[model samples]
Target: MALPVASPVVIRFGRLGDTVLLAPLLRKLHQRYGTPCRLVSLGECARTLYQGSADVAQVHWFASQHGWLWTNPRRLAVALALRSMREAPFYICEPDVRTRTKVRPMLALAGIAAEHCVFIEDIPLGEGEHWADWLLRFADLTPAAFAATPALDASRQLRAPSIRATPDELAEARAWLAAQGVDAAQPLVLLQPANKRTMRWNGVRAADDDDKSWPVSRWAKLASAILQWQPDAHVLLCGCAAEAGYLASIRAEAGLPRLLAPTGGLPLGLLRGLMELAHSMVSVDTGPAHLAAATGCPLVVLFGHRWPSMWVPRSASGSAVTVLGGLPHTPRVDQIGVEEVAQAWWRLPPRPVDIVPAAMGERRARVA
Candidate 1:
């Protein structure tokens, strides 16, 4: 019997950050077809991309066994399951050169014929094109929907475990602060000091010594300066628990107010809420920077290899500025000096006392 035709779309990237980066384009696909799209994903990123969107109706995991029939039972099981379910014309979207080679054979073994497969290689590299925009060129869709600002829809909203901090979670965060003898009344400034591998490849490369983050001594200096400018302002160091030592180093150097690593670990929703609550955020070109943009927080981002015009935050209500170095390859940490970062922060428009405050306060109240 012939199976029902499914709107076939496969994004083969394995990183959560990349999946989030591609979300706008995915939303565009949903808008254009008004059909639920299927996702073929692997690893932790499955959680990030499949946020229960009406558009993303189903998700299939990539099977690992390809060389031998019975070598890996799990891989075979996944493949057989997908085959028995249905077969449809499949499109493979590869935005990165590295992923293209890795994902080709995997798709082929899953009963996706070569003729039905579409490889993306035509997207041009330019000064002002976002990574999202560059990826969207692969799909048979218009750029208008891709360029359209994303609204806070059901899919985009952070689910309970990811970003939405529960009442218990919020109480825990406050309790932790109190235990440390730190005050929570003061507005929080979030500092995300690490950069992921792709971001490093395109922009800031990792430091050779101990695989530590880009020398955020400059960021520490700037944090101190912000506090000097506003003594009551408190800074919160945020990242995975694995980043706790790095946070400790920054805290020692900068004398930052409270260093809070999510004890239960940061789910995407809580991280978004943290960004939304922050008065501002200073980060390297990383996933947190992208997540921060979704919160409409005032952001000053430092761009190294990537162009600011293409990837800078795109919120209508908030202010954001990106400082870019004029280098084609990843910009060295030293190239982006503290003065440049401070200058960008200085340029942020002052938050309006009445209207803006009311809107933000309302959002906080709702979250509370």
Candidate 2:
């Protein structure tokens, strides 16, 4: 089969973290085709998430979790939207069987055929291959690979799941941070203690039994400990407006000064700025954690029983990152103690910031 006349069309949908991981493949495909790629997802974040990237030409997404009645229309709508664009190669990045079946019809509705599509399940992963790396490898199968002259440093944007923030966005975020009293001259600690699984009650299971839960009380203690360790440090309980309630709970429980909650959730652009500006972060295995790592924020991430190598957020080269739990034998993230989190966070070599005298004294003794 020949390359599409326009560019590659990638169908990959995931939660925020999964969406972030898709960056590498889009980048690789764009370089190989010398064109910005079109993206399809099950959720809406991809647009805002990729707003600053030229590599993603457009993002089309709809709800996928509901029953067929609601989802099928959305699927058709997506197919209709893509139909307006030129024909392109389709890469289905999901390994899930149900998801793959769901996407096939969408492609069909768009008049894209099987030969033009590459289901990721067709490519078995190499031993211990992370999914992000697997996606990067999948990008190599494009017809562009056989050309005499290849892209310079072709497919080399593999370091981390990066998101670009525009200069205007960064400046806007800085102004907002300053207004919120986020003193750049002091140690800024960001915390992501809420996950969708735990935040929404499903009735069938307790949220605490899940991997994402680490006890809201425990989060309070961790925040207090951070404040105690660095009096000048500002702890921001970061999440979307929906999770503002959880943020409030943690802020109230911690009951200490210098901890602030954003009035609404941090916008994607501002969130990127926060990740870049923060000295470090502590989070459970979640989307913002992935985003934070991409921004080169030193991360102390708590993992569940799943294999860490499969889903752990990869920070930029040589940045501080500590992965605790996620071992095969690990039962749950709650099994991870508050002290363990603090120790891992303390061990991270502080990201460069203009430190106040009070915080500077503590960082020198703790970073080593």
lDDT of 2 by residue, 71-142 (tens): 578767887776655356677898889877777666666777555667788789887788798888777664
How far out, in Å, is residue 346 in model 2?
A: 1.1
Query: Native-vs-model 2 lDDT?
Result: 0.76
What's the TM-score of each model vs. the native?
0.71, 0.87
Q: Highest lDDT: give the candidate number.
A: 2
RMSD of each: 7.4, 4.4
Task: Give the C-alpha lDDT of model 1.
Answer: 0.55
Score residue 276 of candidate 2 by CA lDDT.
Answer: 69
lDDT (tens digit, per residue) of candidate 1 on 173-248: 4555466465555566677776545233244444652122457577678778777765666677666655656666
Give the backbone clash total of model 2. 0
